[model samples]
Target: MQLGIDQDQADANSRITAIRAAVLLTRSMELWRRERLDPETVLINLAVIAITSERLMRGGLDPKHNSLDVYLPLEKLQGCNVASIAAATGLNRETVRRRVKSLTSAGSLIRTASGDLALPPDKVQERSAQELVRRQLEALVRFANESLRDGVLMLSDEKG
Candidate 1:
């Protein structure tokens, strides 16, 4: 059986998805800045990692299965160089370098032999990752429960 959605429902879903993406991105930036104490540095670091991750994923690397070795390969992931990151983020090369240096010193980033930066899983703090994941899951669950309570979705056992 195929599930179908009306045009209006599809449009609403698209709008909701866009809004959620915007909110999530803003909140993620805020959280990173609060944790790092520097918005520029946090943003640059995030950009570097994000660019690197996307490049690797596009190259057929499955992050969920390959671990850090795949994402932060020693051979350098294409399009993840400091220059590309600086260009994509519209940040000065020097500023990107400075933030990359800081992140490297903090052990949250690693530089490959070719000078590409990446966020290896080993460099990440497990507790911090766990906490962030927990917070995100809680937020999603709370949102779903609130929607259910407000009659946006009916419980499985509820009579129509």
Candidate 2:
């Protein structure tokens, strides 16, 4: 009788452990879903950065003119030559120099020279916006593929 009771207790404990693990796994998935950033917002920011860098490279605007016309309304412009970009974009003289360096480092913008920092035109939209959209979609496809693969593996494990 004691042996039977011992086996039952062990079975119950095993079941409890499995339930806790399953709950943890579910919570992790929920967190990942909740933390996903909006892709459209990310794409817009990237577009602004790319366009600004392209402008600087092609010399559409002088780096010593106005920086705010370019950098202020954009996201993530650090690690660049701000005085130069400020001259072009019309951005704040002080902020331009400081933020430009940081933006360039973060890949949001690029500098054409040590002194000039206008964005290149190609980065913005030279021919058609469709091309830009296509490139962005391609990147999203790759991201989705990786996520789907992980989801499938998780689903299979749960069933087995």
Candidate 3:
């Protein structure tokens, strides 16, 4: 009986976390769309942006390359290529390719000579972009607080 109750609590916690996460993601997407950062499309554009940027922090954090004001030079960013993006996103390669092209043309992504893709440094440095990021961070903090209040997040995850 006790074991069953423990399992039920675990399952409830997982479901609550998922519910909070979905709401947070929806809010973030709303902010992203309102910013008009990728007017050409939606999920694919966001997916490509996130997938291509994995190189910067995948191994370790390099302050020089990862900071908003200090992104790697175009030649050295080594962002993911189409194949990797498609693999990560599980989208058809052709669809990923088309979206990447569109995003690149829209100035949301930068395709380099090596066929790697990354964001233009100026894209993040702009005041509006930074503001959008700040709002998203605020939403994340709210999500954490809500989760803790709901008992979805472990107390160990809380901080002073």
Candidate 4:
């Protein structure tokens, strides 16, 4: 006896498998970065604040229409409090407080008027952040183009 599979169904399954692998690879990179930043995890947590604060400020704005100049105003951005960060990251409140204090001292994070934590506007434009973003974008583009060429992903008819 032999099992039979249709070509269309097999193609769809291959695409799904490829996407799942890509997702795992992306998450592994994030975990690796977190581990490489510090064994204590303080730097990684601080980095999360620096990255997420920008996204939170951007809110429902289209990327093309959003300007860093408009969103980089530290005062205009909402800060993430220790409790919220703790809840989001699954870290204890004390750990969050301690790490946040260290980050503040290191100039990576600042204390807001409401005693919440935020990334400094200057920090947002730091060379390290810029380089990291550049490298990540390149990696993503390479992955996407390779996937398209391999027929594991499809692009719609829309062009930007």
| Most TM-score-accurate candidate | 3
Which ten residues in a row are the worst by lDDT in model 4?
A: 1-10
TM-score of 2: 0.24
Stretches off by above 4 angstroms in model 2 are 1-81, 84-90, 113-115, 120-160
Better of 2 and 3 by TM-score: 3
Q: Write the per-residue lDDT of candidate 1 for residues 27-129, one digit (tens) a residue.
A: 6666666565577776676676678667566768654646422234445455466687788789898988777777789877777666677766564435665
Instruction: Rank candidates by lDDT, best first.
Output: 3, 1, 4, 2
Q: Write down the lDDT that model 4 would get.
A: 0.61
How many clashing pairs does model 4 include?
Answer: 0
lDDT score, residue 112, model 3?
74
User: Per-model C-alpha lDDT, please?
Assistant: 0.62, 0.43, 0.69, 0.61
Residue by residue across 81-147, what tens digits does model 4's lDDT show? 7777776767888987888788789886787777667777676666666666566677666666655
Write the residue-wise lDDT of candidate 3 on 1-160 in tens digits: 1111234444778877788899998888888889665533556656556765556557665666555655556654555777877776677889878988877888877867787777777876778777887899999989977866665554443334
lDDT of 3 at 32: 84
The weakest ten consecutive residues by lDDT in model 2 span 151-160
Best candidate per lDDT, number?
Answer: 3
**Model 1 lDDT vs. the true structure?**
0.62
Candidate 3 residue runs with Cα over 4 Å from true position: 1-10, 37-42, 64-66, 157-160
Question: lDDT for model 3, on a 0 to 1 scale?
Answer: 0.69
Between candidates 1 and 3, the TM-score winner: 3
Q: Which digits, one per residue and each the tens of the lDDT, describe model 2 over residues 68-111?
A: 32333222223334444445455566765555555557554555
